[model samples]
Target: MVREHQYEAARFLWGEGAIERMGEVLAAAGVDRAMVVCGEHVGANEELMDSVENALGDRHVHTYTGARGDTPLGTVETGVETFEQHDADGLVSVGGGSASDTAKAISVFAAEEGRTLHEMKTQTTDDGESHIPDLPAPKTPVFAVSTTLSAAEVSNIFGVTDEKAGDKVVILDEKIRPRVCVYDPAATATTPASTIASTGMNALDHAVEILYSDGHAENPFYQATAEKAIDLLVTNLPAAVNDRDPEALAAAQLGAGLSGFGIVGGISINHGINHPLCARHPVSHGDGNSILLPHGIRFTYDAVPERMARLAGALGVEVEGGKATDEATLEAMCDVVRELQEEIGVPYRLRDVGVDRDDFEAMAEIAAHDSAMANNPKRVTASDIVALLEAAW
Candidate 1:
């Protein structure tokens, strides 16, 4: 277990109308000029943009509405150019994960002085050894106005895809975590139920994986937070998924933000494979996670059986305790995840969602060495990953 003593904390503002206090948050951070990074749909809404501009007062200098799912390398480069051209002192990420990730990519590149994005790309050897080039902390801070439950704003890691290589490179640094995270249910009102539900499952995956992660074995703080995150997501996600209730949206947002706390400690097998699936297919990150989560739990259950029992309980499964083997409780946990996936209208099998069977070998090969794989509760070989993918398929 690669345990560390690091504990990461972020400033979070949650409720309705959180965006109304944007100027106050920015001013407190000593930001003078800021640019908005968002998706086309959010950017095209002139009224909403005007409202945000008004909230920023004179600090809002430009809007770059180019962020897309997975934040491809070219998109990050384009956003960097916009940030420099506008002379923005900070960033207001106005959408979901992709937008926030794009802003983080811009912040990192901007801080590197003369280095190009390619020069800053994470280096991984043929033997699966990886190296992240050290760069200075970003002078410019990020203030996020989240529209989904993915909780991208709460973590410093960014996943940027290289389309040419068909791989997503992840970068990590504490400095890239948002200076302020604004979670207003009203902001999420425009999001589709499918998107909301998928991301909610993604949050649940984070909490579940953290519970069994060896890296977090000594950090009770992370375990406690992960437990609460699971409870909140399980209790509130149904309302958000079924009714689109604003109150539930707020709860899910808070839950996701809390679950994000685990990311600093680490996540295990589920996230390890999920990233590679997204990089290989045209799958959304959240969808990939939702589809693969149950299988991941099953794969690592024996490594952390007690935690898996607790997870089953958190998911509302009634498992017999005393004489029951860990296998029974673990199966119950997977059952609940599958039930939730169906309840939220997400695909459960790899083939059900159009994953190409021929590419399974290639994807498993990449996943076996993905950076997040380092933290899995049990070490996995490429052949092990292939078997898991086949089982899901």
Candidate 2:
């Protein structure tokens, strides 16, 4: 059995006033020439950036808001070249996962090194299976600013998109993790409600899947956090998406980060299966996870009924009286997902999101073969995944 080790430690901000700490870090790290990597659209928030600049005045901050959706390799490479041209000292990513992930790629590429990020482009599952990129030593610090509730900032991993292959791949390493995460609720307010809803579901699935993972028995601490994350999401997400209530936004940001920490500690199959849907259909990560959630939960329920019951209850689905049986409770979980989706403006079925049924088989083959499948809660076959895809379809 593999032993669990909680080896990540990164600073986080919950309520308001965290922006002060964000400034403190920028001054402390003294990032050579801090590049604020965000989406080009964010340029409209000049007042916000000016506010941050005032806070981080000590660091010679530069702006590089270009990459959106997927963290492109070309973007990262170009950004690295730009950073070098400007003699940038460090990175300050102020978007969602893509910008931060692109920063990680830049940090790796720009560090004082022999290998360059180019050498690390192709990775195998295992470190020994392939050569470790000629990584630079004591690489540049990467500070993150999250404008969304998706907790990718807290995890010691980066998700990148290979546009050439239309696939997402993760760069999981402690070094890639952020040095600090600045969470300003005001920042999230600028994000689209639909984006908020998508990431919320992804965060929700993270909480749900972790509670039932085979590794759950081994990592009790995170299980508690996962359950609490689910509870917070159930009560707070609708409000966050519906009204952008300040309190709700605060709760969601904190909950999503906590859940992210838990999920990274051990994600198992849901992520494994969800990756293909996102990769194959160009579906947004959060929406893809949301679309597959109930089905994924249902499939895993047979192996961990009690856990599913807890999830069902956490989702605010009453699992009482007639629902005492796992079957009823499990179905109720699906209802809860649908309710949440509708509440958050998500479509009831995959077709609404433009996922084609014709490609289900092909996606299933990739999903079943995905590396995450090896540690899934329930064993999965290509056919089983195809069936689940059909059900979600």
By summed lDDT, the worst window of 10 consecutive residues in model 2 runs over 122-131
lDDT (CA) for every model shown?
0.80, 0.72
TM-score of each: 0.93, 0.87
The C-alpha RMSD in Å for every predicted model, in order, reads: 2.6, 3.7
- Candidate 1 accuracy as lDDT: 0.80
Displacement of the residue 90 alpha carbon in candidate 1, Å: 0.2
Identify the candidate with maximal TM-score.
Answer: 1
Off by over 4 Å in 2: 1-5, 109-137, 317-325
lDDT of 2 by residue, 2-77 (tens): 7756656787765566665766786666654677777786656876666666667767557887656657667877
Clashing residue pairs, candidate 2? 32-89, 33-89
**Candidate 1: residue 205 Cα off by (Å):** 0.9
lDDT of 2: 0.72
Q: Give the TM-score of candidate 1.
A: 0.93
